[model samples]
Target: MKRIQIEKIFHHNAYRIGVFFDKDFEVIAILKRIGATYSGSRRCWYLDYSKASYHKLRFHFPDLVVVTESSNTTLVTGINNRDLSPIASSSVLQLDSTLSNPEHKQTQITSEKLKLQLLPSIGKYWVFKMHFHHEISKQLLKIKGVYWNGNYKSYMVFRNETVKQHVEAVLGVGSFFGSDYFTKDLLPVKGKIKILPHTEATSWMEVYVPKLVAVHEKLKRFSLARFSKSKNCYLLPAAPIVMDSLHLQFESTGIDIENLLPKNYLDKRNLPNKKQLDLSKTKKSLLDMVPVQAQTYLSSMIDTLLALNYSSSTLRTYCGAFIQFLRYFEFRNPESINREEIIRFLGSLMERGLSATSGHSMVNGVQFYYQQVLGKVDYSFVLPRPKKEKKLPVVLTMEECLQIFKVVDNPKHKLLLLIGYGAGLRVSEIVSLKWSDILFEEQKIHIKNAKGKKDRMVMLPYSIVTSLQLYRELYKGKHYVFEGQFAGEPYSTGSVQQVMRNALKLTGLEKKATVHTLRHSFATHLLENGTDIRYIQQFLGHSSIKTTTIYTHLTKTAVDKIQSPLDRMVDLKSKKKLEE
Candidate 1:
């Protein structure tokens, strides 16, 4: 028996909120009451409840004058706030008392009777009850797997032949017959059925037919309801049977339906069961399950790699990448995507005006979103990153670099440029540096929470020691070494870039160089002075030796040191001529 109750009703000027309760007195429905508010000059308004019953109870009901047929499903219009749980549960008793006959029970009102009454003019195929199920079945039928139909419900089998035997023993031959009768007599007229002869005589009959898919799906929902009630016990009569069914289906077909069950729904840990988590809200609004917000997806992805508490800059970069992915696909729903779609999307990005390095970053960003946040497997083949071009790192000459240092007038700005170039720090790393990170005695700076969130130390050159000392005398802040022009804020990367640009213009050296060029010059000059490539890589905080190799081409040290074969031969001939 299904019992529905009205939990609450609130009336406003032209709107209301109605809450409903089920047989268990659990809140099952929240109805939005929409009404018309019109001035004397406005058009007339009408409220319809015929279709609203499928979702929830509302404040207004359809006018009987317009829908005169009582068989069209009665609408409890304009109902005052009342608790209907007890009334609905005792519907049979009240109904029986009204009829004054034991034979005239509420159970006699089968799906056929109610269906016909609701739409008497329609054919059997157009039965209202069948129509409702057919619409809802569209979602359930998408699940391709093996399941069993109880008398009026369906359940996906998990495993265990013993559980099947138990269900069969309890059900007997009536299992098949009951299922058939329920489908033909109680279900909508258009519904299909499959009846089979008993195979083992336990209680179940080996029924095999595709039409049973719908029945199994509908019954599965009812079984979930039962599981929700029995918080701390075996889920069903045949747990082993359900389990074995899932295994058998998976073995025969590659689809793994068992994993499709929400992790929070079933608890297998310690083999213990707790009160089932509320899935009604989730089930009712399937759209909410998708990661609609880019921030939500990015936030979740970052939590897996780093702690949930990450810097705001890290959060923005991760989220921006994810959002760009969604925009590239025109914000297509993730459900519509597959491996090939991702492959094509990544491939198309190559010619869409993005540089190879930028494309590589995008691939990493999109890959992390799907594989980590979405929990999708088989993404290894989707992301095909483009090859980066091999090019020498741009470096400034020592004279030009000195000229830039001399041009910067602000003491704090001068120190920032010196450190960024001096220590080979990324723009982000420069902003995050603190006063305590510097160790004057050791002539090193502790780069804590650097790129990839790893900690490392960098050398502090003696040349810049005096400059830093002078800047500290002027600024004297406790935390950040490079404080913004405004009192307490850390200087941003934009501000630093502006400082570098202004310095370049003032020095009259405009070769289109960035703040990073200073670090490149530092590396190139160190290489020229005979610093090992491996040492340069560590000092520059390179994750790979390959990244540091670009500076080798710019150093000119190797080429300058080489004695060309032509030069040796020319020198020998010249010496012979002189001797002759």
Candidate 2:
């Protein structure tokens, strides 16, 4: 499950908040109830900048991390006007003293005068509007609290008396007290650049140039500018110096440079390797290379799936198979394509090493598109389906399973393996297990939302109960019985697989088995110990008895009970010799 993140941005004289969530309906309903309005332009929700709005957000989402650009010193206090009387009065007094200074008279009457105007903004900040004069602007930019706001076309400074007085003294009162300031005319020649996260490993930046100002040839060449069709913007590799130059250029354009990029962008750790970067590029290329008509058909297929209430996983699988089918035919018109073409395509897939199960899935996707979407009843693409493989699942001997447990020293790893085998839980089911799912009193594991969205109860072995308690004490999981680094997040399936692999290697087991093999061993062992087939089916969450019967082939109970005809013949021969 994706965690919720609330990012508060000070944009266009208001606090624009963007929420990243996993589409939980209750959370969205809460946001709507709080009077937060969504903005299509910015792709986020917003409320007028105020203390009450911020508090309301905090109230609704108490645990969500709020990402902000402002420094700790400049954090908004969310205090009422009645509470801000002292600070307001002190600021007015400081302005009075700066205006009465007699020592600054000469410098005030210079040829090119600087003008500063302060306007009250949201929270404890003031918008300082001014025009650019080459010499004086440099001096103003050097101040710690002063920074430009691009969207507002003004500078922002902490509402502090000392900072305001210092600005007046530097600009000279004559230069600071003019009403002819125009921020639009003073817009920086070089435009804004924004760096954002593309993935965990990669970073991408967008270059938004001013209409009048042309991009510098040297900067463009150094950055190796490439246009991304998906983003509809030019992108550059997020090198450290390149990012610094982009920020410096935008800051020169008069935008405040506070936390311009994400916190992780500057860190020189776990950067994307060449292969990862190439894979991203390849995915983009494939998306862009898709023909327009094929994209239309793909969208129609997705819409149909949604209308029919198909599961998300099924929709994703079908769409992927359809995309491959379209690409194979160079995205030919779907209406013009015939059954023979689809038959040829399925044959081609087999020739290229596609498994029978995958080929069946592809056929289903195409059949759905034509029969359901196009309303074609006679779309007969009857190709010989490949025979399903009847290979028995690899089961670990009891001794080998014990050996694996002995080698896995980490308590978490041991518990994960033991639970998988002990409770006959699938890999996905095991990772998704929450603390509430474990009924300690009943000694049953409540396996909710298993395969086919069915829920069942499984026996929790008494032998591992103490071990489970110890692991829980060591990890202190917040939600999931096994949690990842982040609180409330489930432990990853990949991590569990790695633990299994390491155990197998340490035990020197040559069997081609995975984490699911533990589940297989559990069912087979239960069958060997005289467990009913119906109970085994329920334990494994199998929809059909035939599915559960596969374990019967691996069990030795029935075979061990039968005496061979050869053994009976040997007994008769021995008896006849004794009689003689």
Candidate 3:
């Protein structure tokens, strides 16, 4: 290896990188390229004290050692004839050999594979286009204003220095950052996919996501996908796998991808809403449902619910249920409306075939206002409610559960279903899961801040742990175990439910199973296998054993063993007939 003398010294009353090396013709040419100039008096080459020259020297001669003396007070002796040797006092700076190492070069090549582009502004948002990397995506998701721009196949963030810094830090150095080509490129007008109604599953599916480049790019993955400008839609050939994948891919992007799925494919059911039912942001406000005369009652009910620190879910439910009462008694004040009127309003809801759960919520909401808000004493007459149906939860048998698992093609979706049945997690709890919750040593998954704001530990099957280990290595999710298209938010329960619905279609199961049905199956199966209900209760994070014991009613393991007296009587009759 060769040596280059690099020293910071006063050159014309300013610091410069003084170079001292032998008069090799090739070395001189390289020094000249680094902006080095020869001083006739000192008889050595010199350049400005900057990093550019230092890097250039390394790039040109990766095998050479650089001895740097940056005391800033080091001065050269005038008219030195011979080459200056290394001074004992000056510190020796070794050359960077990593630049010449093949392993290091491979690392650079791997990192360089990830490229990014700055897309045109999407309304107020600045867009960044790149291939998704979990770690890089996680950092971007940390910014509060970042959005997954599905239309652009990019991330949209609010224009700010914090976002800019985060982007620069997360994405390593690249020339793409300084490029201007993307700015001039015309972008398509963004929109969402609209599925056209079709009768047959085998027929071509028509999608209307106008100029949505992301959708266009995705369509290119399948064969014979065409854009029909005449009909203002895109027509694509149908495949069940593609349909299921399409829903799973974009559903997490905050789009209602369920609507894009064909009805015949999913076998649609009147499944209870997976969303929180918060109507606060909807266009039709609860106040709008009531007459102008009765707006105050509705407003008061909401304000009261909020003041009481009721959960947002409860607040929405009460507001929704109470609004019906307000609209019915529009002419009269809430105080004037008695038990009979309240009963009549509920009766009407029952006539409309509202579910028992909804009916109960409506009753509880009205009761809160009358008893707490109005401070009313209980009258002799009871305020009536819809009869509470003792309906059994739908449970999938062990073999049936395997069938559903077999049909699930996506690994993440499969793991999601596995966790649901294997761990017995609720739809809400499953979505809110974070990577930090998984405990390998304890063999448990921590369910924190769950229903009733309580934390509990649930068993993590060895099978799930193995899958999770492989998945974590691949995805490396920082926040949630399963993230949505956007970074920080948990996977939407609705999306998981859609995945469940899609999987059931592939299997010929007639049961109207939901994501919750997996939880029910988990509990019932565990009970059948003789897992104590008390432990099951704890594992399920149930507040009461009664809630857990419901599985007992569904598990026919014990009941199947009991022989009927009629069977015994039939055997006796058969014996008598044979004897006769």
Best prediction by TM-score: 3
lDDT of 2: 0.64
Candidate 3 residue 325 Cα shift, in angstroms, is: 0.9
Residue 406, model 1: Cα distance from true site in angstroms? 1.5
Per-residue error (Å), model 3, residue 103: 68
TM-score of every candidate:
0.45, 0.50, 0.52
User: Per-residue lDDT of 270-361 in model 3, one digit per residue for the tens?
Assistant: 11122323434321355555567777777778777767666666766777667655655654787777777778777866764566777788
Clashing pairs in 3: none
* Candidate 3 lDDT score at position 125: 55
TM-score of 1: 0.45
RMSD (Cα, Å) for all candidates, in order, is 29.4, 25.9, 34.1
Summed backbone clashes in each candidate are 19, 2, 0
Off by over 4 Å in 3: 1-284, 347-355, 375-382, 576-580
Residue-wise lDDT of candidate 2 within 364-436, one digit each (tens)? 8888888888877785646567666677999998888899999999888889999999999998888899988
